[model samples]
Target: MYGVSTYALHSLPLPAALEQIAELTDYVEVMDDGCHYIESAEPLLSYDLRYSIHAPSRSVNIASTLEPIREASVRVIEDCFSIAAEVDADVVVHPGYFAWAADRERAKRQFARSLAHLSAAAEERSVRYAVENMAWEFFFLQTPDELPLPDGAGFALDVGHAHIMGCLPAFLQVPIDHIHIHDNDGTADTHSAIGSGTIDFAAVMATVGQNGITPVIEVEGIDAVRSSISAIRPYL
Candidate 1:
């Protein structure tokens, strides 16, 4: 089955977004940011749809070299894990980035440490999570060579980000536990409708089918979400 992310209705309250998305698909990935930031599963309990959370990414960097910042980032995700546990949902997270070129090695070390902590916490809560590949430079795990995730972490493949980075084909080769599907020109992460951009959705849909994964339509607006669902329906 296919799913939709609340990101398309980010301008609305979480409940409102969920209400609209539920009408379109039985599965939804909550983009926990802005108006949709989830502090508890109480709001989610009302929905009948299956859930996967895109944990809060803004202002959260698990790879920060500063001890407090890195620790705080882990804590933020730990709280998300608590909510996921209550809902029996999986989560999607971004790999942290370094501020300067000189700090890349330090940031990687910090990220590894944070990942270890998160793995243990997730196990405790019985919630699974996948680390997503990023679109820009200075971010960790942007390529397949960065594989063999530390502490047995899972992977969430974002096709738009991978396309922007010019590595979608390589990322598609990796074992993906979760996926975010959207369209974009080869140069930017536009999160456009499925057929509105250059991405070869036929190949993407084929891989998703092979993996038996539900692809989350992570586009820009409610209209784009509808368009994406229509575009991918043929593949589904």
Candidate 2:
């Protein structure tokens, strides 16, 4: 099935945001962030929507070299997983990034450890944990060969991020369990509509469908969400 993220209406209140997209789609990937919280789930539970969650990644890095900070990041993500279990939602998470001075190999090792912790937690709660590829220069899991993908964990393919890294085809070569579909200008994560940028949606959609991966259109704004749906309908 296809869906849209609550991120598409990021500025609105969570319940109102769900209201806006409810008619347009049956699946809704809630973005568990400061702008939208798990507290909104009570109101949403009454709806007929199936859910997934994008765990908060804007401020916390689970792979930080600092022990205390890394632990805190894990705590935050565990909280997100708890929320996901409550909503019966699968989670999409960014494989944490590292600073320029941090030991890249060490950071990668630490990230693997973090994923192990999160994966266990997800398994206990019966929630699917997915690690998303990142677009930034220092992000981890940029290539399929580098992805450990840990036991019980899954891959969340972000087409926009893959485009930014020039690794869309490389990513498609891997097993994708979930997807975040959006367009970008090849230089940034602009979250543009499907046809608004350089990525090839037809091929992307074909691959996603072939793989049986449900895609979350990660666009921002209601208009963009509607436009993207229309642009992608044929692929579905």
Candidate 3:
């Protein structure tokens, strides 16, 4: 099945974005953030849609060495997961970054501790949590080899980020349960429409098709979302 993330309509209010998404596709990954939030899930329950959530991460740093910051991050994400249960949604989360002034190794350990907590929390709620790869210069999970999640957790592979980092093939090597599909120039995470950038969606889709993995298009506009859907339709 194919879905579109509300990320494409991030500028719109949650209700309006959900309305548009309902018209475009039956599946939507509601990005729980500023313009889109889990609090708006009540309206979503009325729609015949399969839902997922891109957990809020703007100020959330699960890898922070400070105990308070890390705990706050977990609470924010857990709140998102709590809402996920009400709407029968899975969640995708950013793995986290090491504090710029902190010890990288120790921060990584802290990050792992956070993932373990989230993994148990997700299982308890009967929702799967998939950690996403980041495109930042010093974040964990930039590649598949960097272990981010414990057993019973999954990976949310962002194809655009992988292409920008020249790690699409490497990221594909990991076990993935969810995907964020979009395009970007090799230089940046522009979230362009499919075929508007250099990444090889054909090969990507071929692999996704064979594996029976569904992807949620994560572009930034309705036209881009529609274009991406058309571009990937042949494989489906």
- Candidate with top lDDT is 1
Write down the worst ten-residue block by lDDT for model 3. Answer: 144-153
Which residue pairs does candidate 1 place in steric collision?
Answer: none
Stretches of model 2 off by over 4 angstroms after superposition:
none
Error of 1 at 19 (Å): 1.0
Root-mean-square deviation of every model? 0.8, 1.4, 1.4
Clashes of each: 0, 0, 0
What are the per-residue Cα lDDT tens digits for candidate 1 across 1-236? 79999999999999999899989998999999899999899999997879999999998999999989999999999999999999999999888999999999999999999999999999999999999999787999888889869897899999998888888898888789999999988888889999999999899999998888989999999999999989999998
Clashing pairs in 3: none
When summed lDDT is taken over every stretch of 10 residues in candidate 1, the lowest stretch is: 135-144
| TM-score-sorted candidate list, best first | 1, 3, 2
lDDT of each: 0.92, 0.85, 0.86
lDDT of 3 at 213: 77
| Model 1, position 40: C-alpha lDDT score | 91
Clashes of 1: 0
Error of 3 at 95 (Å): 0.6
Best by TM-score: 1
